[model samples]
Target: MPRTSEPWRKPPKAWKHEPGRPAPGRTHEQTDRRHPIGTRAHEGLRQASQGTRTLRTGPPHPMSTPFETLTALRDEWQALQPLSAENEARLWKKLRLWWNYHSNHIEGNTLTYGETELLLLHDRTTGNHSHREYLEMKAHDVGIEHARTLAADKSRLLTEGDIRDLNKIILKEPFWKAAETADGQPTRKEIIPGQYKTTPNNVRLPQGDIFFFASVEDTPPRMAELAAWMRRELDSPTLHPVAFAAKLHHDFVRIHPFDDGNGRVARLLVNYVLLRSGYLPLIVRTEDKANYLTALRLADAGEIGALVEYFQSLAAQSLEWGIKAARGESIEEPSDVEKEVQIFVRGQKSGDPGPPPRTPTQVRELILHGVEPFFRILDQKLATLSPLFAETGKPDIASVAQKIGLLLRSTAASPDYRWEKRFDFFGYTGKADAPFDFSTTIQVAFEPADYRICCDGNVLKSLRYDEMLTKEQSEHLAASILKAAFER
Candidate 1:
């Protein structure tokens, strides 16, 4: 017996193309168009009912929901704070200097650990600098002093035990406020008898009834589990030091074992990992807090691809800034490549017909079709540059041509493949002078689901179709085609 196809399913609602842009239904034209579609369909029935009229209304805007409001608040907070290159360079220098100084002090060169801790604690507690700034100041103070007294002291390198001890010492300070239960109960806030002398003040969460002891939680067991996972994943002998450091930083922050000061400790851990692996310590500035948080949040949500892309971008920016600082170049606002990518994505689907479908193949195809024009143009430019391959030390023209052929063949072989034309010239240089510089976009979609495909600023196709393919099959085929087309 032939298998019957399931009823066509609608796509999951796509994110509004532009950040902060209201949904399309709120637009006057959209509402008007929707009314006419329903009204025209029931015109015969209305005539039979003696020209009766019925107005249609939708549910109130979901933006008023508490979760939506909180999400908006988070977005606003992220937008209000941006990290700039100049601040990042300054912070990096400070951290390096402080690390050197502290290493020397710990090695009994001149300053003692107690004195270093006092300086850091005072600076941090008094708000002499922002939390990130204070870290930079303390690290640099230590690094500079270490260089002056023991430039060749290889023995001063910090061990794992030293890191643990440092964390303990830092937590012992009264900088972090502890959390309290939200029962409105009044109790003595002083240190209890036989309790550790280094207890911190307690505070309550904004919305929860739970309490948190500053930097003191039952985290050892969790930390051990996470560390075991890390050791297993990162034990490769040939891993690039920078990549390893980035991964470690991401994993540590995700665990978030510390009740307070996790950010500070995570930054230090990244530096320690990098330094131990022969890379310079990096200073992620407070000014870059929005971008940092965005990356971390995305990672926490299991978007590993997006997080890796963010890290690659951040690493590149840090390196470029470091080079500029070394050459005495003015450190101004760095170009935000991540922002550019986001803007490009938002612009591509700003006026989508509606939400996308749920089937994996449909979703994959929607994204692929949306980005197809950009890839097509990019491929064309690469083809034009094929003649300079030998000079550029890249693959030969024949190999590139062969790869393109394979991509075209694979795309043509797919039953779900569809092609559409789109105009996209945001970053194009030569085409600026051309009158009709529209590009060709190929949209490949699966049946059995409804998908909305848009490119540049226009909607191409919006329809409900059968879902004829699985997600894994779609991804495997799509990846092969794209790899052949673009990687060549």
Candidate 2:
């Protein structure tokens, strides 16, 4: 019989080593199945693809709806951004491998945060993988590096060094090179040559370039002018820090100073500004790209309010997600809130009272008529629970309403209610409107129990009228309200 070597057989005692560490010359074999080099890049591409898919599809679900898949991937992306550099590197390695395995499959390739990060790191540094893998590895590396810096210090205070460090980390890798003409003017290449003579619209920079994007001669002068104006705007005491940062982000991107990577760099810069000014980082997921870009474009054309509103919404969404993730709650959505909102709004316009009003005034009326009695009951229950609001010397209605309004407004603006129109509606109208309508179809349109607070399409809080008011005092208040309404 021909001599046969068993490839599966271990090479005697010499090949084995300590159980924990890898063999001397060999790096640890990934139990996670990620490629060694293209890890981070793979994850970046996977996340980008997933985000695109989610926006195209609906929300997350068990059956792996495209939106669900994308949202899952995005959550992973957000989680990984704040890890230590070493941990991030390790995670990217595994993430890359995980991405590769799932690259061809729509159903089977799912990766958690840890797996995606490791794969991304492994695939990028090793360079042992295919070119496609290499590209993905590079992209993910850039993305994660940026994300890691964003998460470095959650207190939202950064020093000059921190800002410089961010700039270095984000701009260190060269993504693309500048093309110049005889007068030192930058040249834009047709990405598709004769078939497409126009500049690549959304091209990102490659690895290791002096600037994040290509800079034309005129671009610098224009940027200087814009920067000067921006400085003035930033110095204005009237501008809120959050609003300033959001506007700056839009203005910088509109300048498009670099040939590529303008959007990414501008966003990163915005995070730096926000963090330095005591605000959280904003991750504009690829799924939100359309709205994000549209808001920026609108601002570029002098629609500052729209952009500020968008940023405020984004900030609220991000914070709520951060809080939920911190609390270890599931961040995925089971229903398509965007679609639901659209449907609900359409119903209202079509004279359907099954859905609450869409406009702010209308929503206010609904809250006053349908939701305030419930809130009053809740207030009574809270007083009974803690003896705070029911204290004999408690302030009068104007004082109490003012106090309640202030408290609820602050909480309403938190991440929990920022993206949640329903909560916002209730919070704004419950205290502001007295003797609210409890009979109008629009007032009692949707059951309170049916509504939930969502952050980036994920539910963060849910409550029923009774759940918020469980005490005897609350029960009595509720009963009285109902009794009076019926009597009328």
lDDT of 1 by residue, 162-272 (tens): 434444434443343334433565543332211222333344443554334323343444354445533432332222333344445665555445444445555565555
Put down candidate 2 lDDT per residue, 1-488, tens digits, no spaces: 22212111112122234433544576543311121112222222233233431211112222122323323434454554564555444333333333232221111222322223334533312112344344433453464455446546544433333333433443344344455543446764422101111232333323433322224444454455545544443332224444456656665554455443444545656655555443445555432333555565455455454555565555555445444544445443322232234333433444323323133333343344334544555335334322211122211222323343444445543322221112111111323345232221111222222333222343322322212212332243344333322333
Per-residue lDDT, model 1, residue 329, is 61
State the number of backbone clashes in model 2. Answer: 52
**Candidate 2 ranges beyond 4 A from true positions:** 1-118, 121-215, 225-238, 332-488
Which lDDT value does model 1 have at 287? 25
Error of 2 at 288 (Å): 2.9
- The C-alpha TM-scores of every prediction are 0.34, 0.34
RMSD of each predicted structure: 29.2, 24.2
